[model samples]
Target chain A: MPTGAEWAIIALSLKVAAAAILLTLPLAFALAWLLARKRFAGRMLLDTVVHLPLVLPPVVTGWLLLLFFGQSGAGGRALQALFGTTLMFRWTGAALAAGIMALPLMVRAIRLSLEAIDRRLESAARTLGATAWRAFATITLPLALPGIGAAMVLGFARSLGEFGATITFVSNVPGETRTLPLAIYTALQVPGAEDSVTRLAIASVVLSLAALLVSEWLVRKGGRHVL
Target chain B: MSFDLAIEVPRGDRTVSVTIAPASGITALFGPSGVGKTTVLDVVAGLVRPSSGHVRVAGETLFDAAAGIALPPERRGCGYVFQDGRLFPHMSVQGNLTYGWKLAPPAQRFMTLAEAADFLGITALLDRTPRTLSGGEAQRVAIGRALLSGPRALLMDEPLSSLDENRRDGILQVIERIRDDLALPILYVSHDRAEVDRLAAQVVELA
Candidate 1:
């Protein structure tokens, strides 16, 4: 019995979360591999930086994003000059905020999976005339499929429920940046909006469960075969 | 193919030095455990770098400390069969074998997929995954995978150590057949003297 406005909010939330995952997946995978496999100078530092958002206060993360992507910011100005596109107070900015918030989860899941792989298998592949890149593509990537699926699910869930960063960066404009969580938050501020809140909360739960189930199915289908 | 190698590896408190200059055929690096038998194979296979020495395989110098020449494993053209049978778990038996075959240069593609599968008697298991393979069958597949790379020499590190007695015998016969059929130089590492006596044309005992 959701209204058209509620449906739009839900759809926008899903789109934001999906776009966030799509933007983050490749970068998370590369960073996870670097953190899991290579031993280089500043590796620990890079790992710490990637995980900072998880430990730092969400408000602090949102404030930092604002400084980095706001109109007055250097990166924002450069982006505007280069692409003639602005992210501040836009739906794309909401996705960017959600992606930044969800990056650590995706990277951690992928790193665990990448670490579980037997490095000796890569050496074996090398001896079998495979270059380092080929060995990773043939062995490491396929083995990490389940973890990648898990990462996508985790990121999607995090982004779907994202509130602080999205509200801070994009300011919850209706039909543009007012995602599900924002819609629910706005409902809580109005008189006699308790019923709408209940409905939105149920929608959130249903969407999260569906994402997890779909991810599990995908993982099972694409995962490495074990006897 | 001929293999000549001298490697010095520091293993904690002990520094182990090993040398093998097998002119031809199967050469067994026989020793007790922790005596650097596998380390020597690792050096020739380009998995480990020796502090001071050289490795020459099939008249090509793979590594020379003095000459500052060191080749990576992919370019070395030496196939290594690990003790645990490191078959790609994500791939089927045929896929695993073809992995190396596809990477090998077209000009160096001397061994075909059919030839390797037939030699190892794994033609029937081509569609199966490595996890479903028995230890002996997995080792055979591993060897076939190695052979399909068109290697100049083969290095096996306790390739049958995980099998039962019957499986060991079966693999030993398969290995013996391989020796009789193929002319490639093979460096086989083993702690079991019986295995060495059964297969090796020359035994290099490590102290």
Candidate 2:
């Protein structure tokens, strides 16, 4: 047996991934709505910026994270001074990095669903006496649920597998910030640690596959039923 | 105060302008497609702003360009039905019917969910979602949703336009029943002369 360390890392990874999805959801909905509903000049540019991390090298994204959230950086310093909390070398920081890395995929999924919604339905809601915001809450939000669910699951799965940004920003500290990927990397390094690595690798694969299944089920159950 | 409306909207090269002062009953906006029949309905519903206009519904000046008063669609209390039935996809039939009930004024809520469902013959389908409904069923649900809002006036933009000939006649019967049973004024839009002739009490031509 590889002991409790491996088990702890797997559980912590799930927790961190879930946290990242929870934290990113509101922003993702706002972004998805803006992208799907608004006709603005810089919409394409904003979309490209959100998706940049997807195409860029993971290590490069990690390096960028380190540069942005490091102790001396502007946002990092401001946070440290205001809340006496440090993001660098912490699990929270790893979650933030994971969240940013997973954002584009989630946004794309949710935005596509939102785009498919019929504007006429919304107009019907308006004429039924719902204000624009109220209409969105009652009609738009419910209608967009399937896509939002898919986005959340996809984001959570992406966060679990995130390595480059997690390693660079949080530095893979044992017990504090060492996620599943980091633990797997460490296991492969030590002498005769193949068994532990194999177990953790299997755990990662199962979790990701489960998440994907949930996403598909959500789409099937919740996708648009009306025009 | 019942319905004092005047609107002129531009669509491509042509302009559609009509003024109708309705005391009561259905006021049908009849014309060919691209003639802006639906455009007039849009203006009345506050879905489309006219190039220059004054719209007064039930004594409230909804849109008066001269006075700089342009009420939002929701505030205008216009129940609009599009060519295609736009029932809320995520909601059960009951939920869709009750959507407007919450928004109507407490005193103005004359139509209850059960009453509307009964009127539209959707009692059995209340638990089903819109996706399960046929075209005629969906339009009936849309009408019920709109009626539950307790709108002072109804704006229907080709409500039967998308249905097959068989389905259209059935839904037209429901519309006639609603007009007879309900007290509110209805502004029905349609390019089809037969539908207009069958359902409308008075016709207002838009060019």
Candidate 3:
């Protein structure tokens, strides 16, 4: 039973998480497919770089994102020049940090499913007059749907829980960057705000539980098709 | 020539070299296990790159190493029936059958879905998924799928090896009708002497 203001925080959190998932889904799938199927130079290095956010401190990842995506940074300058937009201290920036944090988990889930595919089916597709892209779209992509679903759910949950990276990169701003975790943190800093903290914590736990249940269902559905 | 292949492919520590020029009809590449019989089919289907040599099927030059011309498997229009019948598990039998049919150009298509289904006796199983099919039924669907693609040449790589003897004879008969009625060039690979003798007009033994 969150108040209207608290509900705004919840809505903002969902928006950020959704945006983060949308931003990372394609890139994560591409990287996952490449890691699972191909043998290329620097593949190991690429894998390590992808997993850096998972192993590195969230603050460090946030620092890296800030360094690259800040207004004065090279990437930030390029983005500004190209898109005439800045992510600095914006909800979009929060999403960017959340996406980077959730990427490794998404990529790992997708890569495992991609690797588990029977590559021979792709070969069979090719011989049946399907182009390389067609084979992947029709055979490999459909077969990996379950994994993709799981990845999205896991990524969404991770994005909702993102605190260190979002706060470090975007800082706390009410109604914009003040998502669930940031709001909870803000409540914690103020005395006599224990009720707000308890409500927010319950909401967070409920959201995470819902995500896990969906992910479990997706895995079960995927298991039936994988064989 | 229906098939004129002289290819050398690397296989682990050793290399496999095969040369066969069959004019037409069923031509079987016979060998024991591990003799790279399937490798030859793979090379013809453009699934494997040959170190040196050329692959000409149905007057079309598919791969010519010296000339630096190698058509990919999709462009080669080779209908390959694998040993295990690699039917897409997620798709229904009808979906699998039409996968290739949908890809082929309208003018190049020689057979319709219904015709192939009728010929292969798989009309009843079209709605079912591949997981529900028996080995022999799956093989029939595989063959029907290949034929409906309207390929210039067919490559059967031990398609009957996975089935029991009773099922094997039934599929063998279906293949015979395809040979006699369709008049399509076929490259069949098998180690079974009796199967080869029954199907192949010419036998090319591989060491």
TM-score of candidate 2 against the unseen true structure: 0.94
Q: Which numbered prediction scores highest in DockQ against the true structure?
A: 3
Sort the candidates on lDDT, descending order.
3, 1, 2
Top TM-score prediction, candidate number: 3
* Candidate 2 DockQ, CA atoms: 0.82
Task: State which docking tier applies to candidate 3.
Answer: high
Chain A TM-score, each candidate: 0.94, 0.96, 0.98
lDDT of each: 0.87, 0.85, 0.94
Predicted complex 2: CAPRI docking category = high
lDDT of 1 by residue, B1-207 (tens): 588878677777888787777577799989898888888888888888888888998899999998999999999999888998988888889998988888888887777888878777889999998989988899999988888888888899998899988888878877777677877788999999989998888899999
- lDDT of candidate 1? 0.87
Kindly report which residue stretches of model 1 are placed more than 4 angstroms away from their true locations once superposed. Answer: A218-227
**In every candidate, what fraction of the native interface contacts is reproduced?**
0.93, 0.98, 0.93
Each candidate's number of clashing pairs is 0, 1, 0
> Considering every candidate listed, which one attains the maximal lDDT?
3
Off by over 4 Å in 3: A80-84
Selected candidate, larger lDDT, 2 vs 3: 3
Pick by TM-score: 2 or 3, better one: 3
What clash pairs does model 3 have? none
TM match of model 3 to true structure: 0.97
Q: Which of candidates 1 and 2 is the stronger one according to lDDT?
A: 1
lDDT of 1 at B138: 93
